[model samples]
Target chain A: MDTLNLEGTEDTPKVILDKENGIFELSGRSLPEDSAEFFQPVLDWIEEYSNDPNSETVFEVKLEYFNTASSKLILDILSDLAEIEGTTIVWYFHEDDEDMEEAGEEFSELVELPFEFKTY
Target chain B: MQTQDLILIYEGEFTQDITKAVLSMAERNMDSSGEESSVKRKVFNVMVECLQNISKHAESFDEKSKAKNNAIFMIGKQEKEYFITSGNIVRKDSVDSLKNKLDKINSLDKSGLKELYKEIIKAGKLSEKGGAGLGLVDMARKSGNKLKFDFEPVNQKFSFFSLQTTIHRS
Candidate 1:
C-alpha cells in the first residue's frame, strides 16, 4: 500500500500510515468542521491495510485537542485497528493534561488493543 | 456592549476562519492571564466546541430577521473563573431538542457525564453535519460545572438560543 502522509494544520492532525514500515501515527489537533469528510480517507487506508495485515503494527496518537466530531472518527479508527492481530497503540499526552490522559483511558477502555500511555 | 473583563466578543457570521481567529485570540488572552496550563487548555477546548456549535447549528437569517448568519460569542473573566458564552438564532422546531439536551447534560454529575460521553462515542452516531453530538457532553465534562442555557422565542419560525460554560482557574 502507498504511504499516507498528511501535514498537520491548526485545526487538523498529521496522519502518517506506512503499511510497509508497520508504522501508523496521528498527531496534533483535530477539530475539522466536517470530520467525516476529513477522516474518510484515513479510514479507507486503514481498512485496506487490514486486509493484508502487517506482522507488527504500531499506531501512535498524539493529539493536543479534538472536537467531539473528531473524537468519534478517532474511535472508529482505533476500533478498526483492534480487529487486526499484533497491533499496539501508543497514546501521548502533555504532563499536566489530565483531560488528555483521561481521554486515552476512555479510548483504551472502549477498544480491545494494547495501549501504552506516555506523557511529555 | 463591551465590559471591563470581556476578553473577546464576536458578532455576525461564524465561519471556519472566524473560529480560528477566536481560538487564537482566546489562547493569547488566556496566556497573558498567568493561569495554569491546564486551566488554559480547558478554556481553549471549551471555546472551540462552543464556536463550532454556533457554526454548525446556528440558523442563518431569513428574510424575516434580515440578519445573515447571525450569532454572538463572548468570553469574560470574573474572579477565579472564565465565562464562555455563545448565542445564535436557531430554527423554532429545534428549540425543544436543544433544551432537552442541555438539561440532560446539566443534570449529570462528573462521573455520570464521563459515562455518558463514553457511551455516546461508542454508539458511533454522527449528525447530518458529521458531528458526534458530543459537544454538549464535552463542555459539561470539561467545565466541571453545570452547562447553562436559555432559549427565547423569535417570531414564530426562530428562537434565539444561548449557552454558557465556565472554566475555573484553580
Candidate 2:
C-alpha cells in the first residue's frame, strides 16, 4: 500500500498515513462541507490495509480541533484499525486540555483496540 | 437610538480582524473582575469558534451580499451573565446536517456525550474543508452549557445560521 498524505487547509486538517511503517497519522483540524466524501477514501484504504494485517500498526492522531461530523469519521478510522490484530494507537493531547484527554480516553473505552494516552 | 454598554455590527473586508478586535475590547473591560474575566474568556472562545465556523463553512453569501464572507458576531453581558451571538450564511443543502449535529449534541448528557463524541472522533472521517468533527463538541464542553442555534431561510437554496450561547459568572 502506498502512503496516503492529505494536506490541511484553512478548514481541513493534514492526514499522513504511512503504509510501510504501519504508522498512520492524522492531525490538525477538519470540518469539510462533504465529510462523507472526504473520509470515504481514507476509510477505504484502512479497510484494505487491515486485510493485509501488518505485524504492528501505530496510528497517531493529534488534532487541535475538528467538527461534529468529523468526529464520527474518527471513530470509523479507529474502529477499523482496531479490527487488525496487534495494532497500537497513540493518542496525544495538550497537557492542559482535559477535554482532549477525556475525548481519547472515552474513545478508548468504546473500542477494544490497544491505546496509550500521552500529553505533551 | 439606544446606548447599551456595547453595540457593534460590521460586514465586509477585514471582518474577522474587526470582530476579534471587539472581542479584545470586551476582555479589557472585564479585566478588573476575576470571575467575569474567566467567564468572558469562555464566552469569547465560543464566540471565536462560532465566527470561525461561519467563515469556514458559510457558502455563497459572501459573494451575494458582498460581505466578503463575513458574519455578524456579537458579545454582550447583562444581568450578571454574558451572551454571545453569531450569524452567517450557508448553502441550503448543508443546513440539515449542521442542525442534526447540534441537535444531537444538545440532546446528550455528559456520559452520553462522552460515548457519542468518542465514536465520532474514533470512527469519524475528515473533510477537505478543515474540520475534524471536534469543534462543536468542544464548544459544548467548554461552555459547560448546551449550544443554541437557529437557521433562517435566506433564499430558495440557502439558509442563515444564527447560534447563541450564554455563560453565567459566579
Candidate 3:
C-alpha cells in the first residue's frame, strides 16, 4: 500500500492518507478548480486499500469549509470506505457546529458500515 | 428597483477572486446591520455555490477570447430582502441535464426533496460532469422558495445559465 499526499490549496483541502498505518485525513476547505480531477486519485487510493483489507481506518476531517462539489467527493469517499471489510469510520466536527453534525449524520445514514460521529 | 441599498457588480477574470471579495465584504460589514449573521452567511454561501457551479461546469464563453475564465456576479438588496444573481456560459449538452435536475428539484415537496437528496446521496451516482446535484436542493430549502433559472442560447452548442436566489432579513 502506498501513501497519499495532496498539498492543500486556497479553495481545496489537503488530503493525506497513509496506507501503511490506516490513518486517512481530509483537512481544510474544498472548492476545487475541478472536482473530478482532484478527487479521482483519492478514489483510486481507496479502491486499492479496499482490497488490502484493514481492521480499522480512522478518518480525520477538519475542513474549515467545503463547497457543494467537494461535498459529493467526500460522500463518495465515505461510501467507498463503507464497502470494504473490517473497516471502521469516525468523523469529528466542531462542538458548536450543528450544521456540520447534521451533515455528518446525513452521510452516516446512507453508509452501511460502522461509523462513529464525534464532537470536539 | 434600486432604492437605498448598496449595489454590487463583479466582472472579473477569475471566480475565486470575486467570491473572496464578496465573502470578505460580508464578513467585515455584516455587523453594521441588526440581521442575524447566520442569515447573512447563508445568503453568501448560496452565491458562492452558484459561482462554483459556473467556474466548474460552465462552457467556455469564447474560443479566441483570452478572458474565458471571466464571469459576472451581481448582488443587491430591496425591501428587506437580498437578491443575488450570477451568470456564465455553458455547453448545450449541460443545459438539459441542469434543467432536468432543477425541474425535478422544483417538483419536490420539502420532505420529498429531502428524500430525493438522500437517494441521490446513497445511490452514489455522480453528475456526468462531477456535480452532486445537492447545491440547488440545499439552496431551495434554505431560501424557502422555488429556485428561478434561465437559459439563453449563445449558439447551437453553447448557452448561458443564469440563476437568481433571495433570502429575507431575519
Per-residue lDDT of B13-35 in model 3, one digit per residue for the tens?
65666667666675555556655
The whole-model lDDT of each prediction reads 0.89, 0.70, 0.74
- How much is the lDDT of residue B27 in candidate 3? 51
Candidate scoring better on DockQ of 1 and 3: 1
Q: TM-score rank, highest first?
A: 1, 3, 2
Query: What are the per-residue Cα lDDT tens digits for candidate 2 across B102-123?
Result: 9998998877776665665655
On lDDT, the stronger of 1 and 3 is 1
lDDT of 2 by residue, A36-95 (tens): 777888898898887786788888888765555566777777778878887888998877
For DockQ, the strongest prediction is 1
Candidate 1 chain B has its poorest 10 consecutive residues by lDDT at B61-70
> Sorted by DockQ, highest first, which candidate order results?
1, 3, 2
How accurately is candidate 3 docked according to DockQ? 0.39
Scored against the native two-chain complex, candidate 1 gets a DockQ of: 0.88
Best-performing candidate as measured by TM-score: 1
What TM-score does candidate 3 get on C-alpha atoms?
0.76
Error of 3 at B80 (Å): 4.9
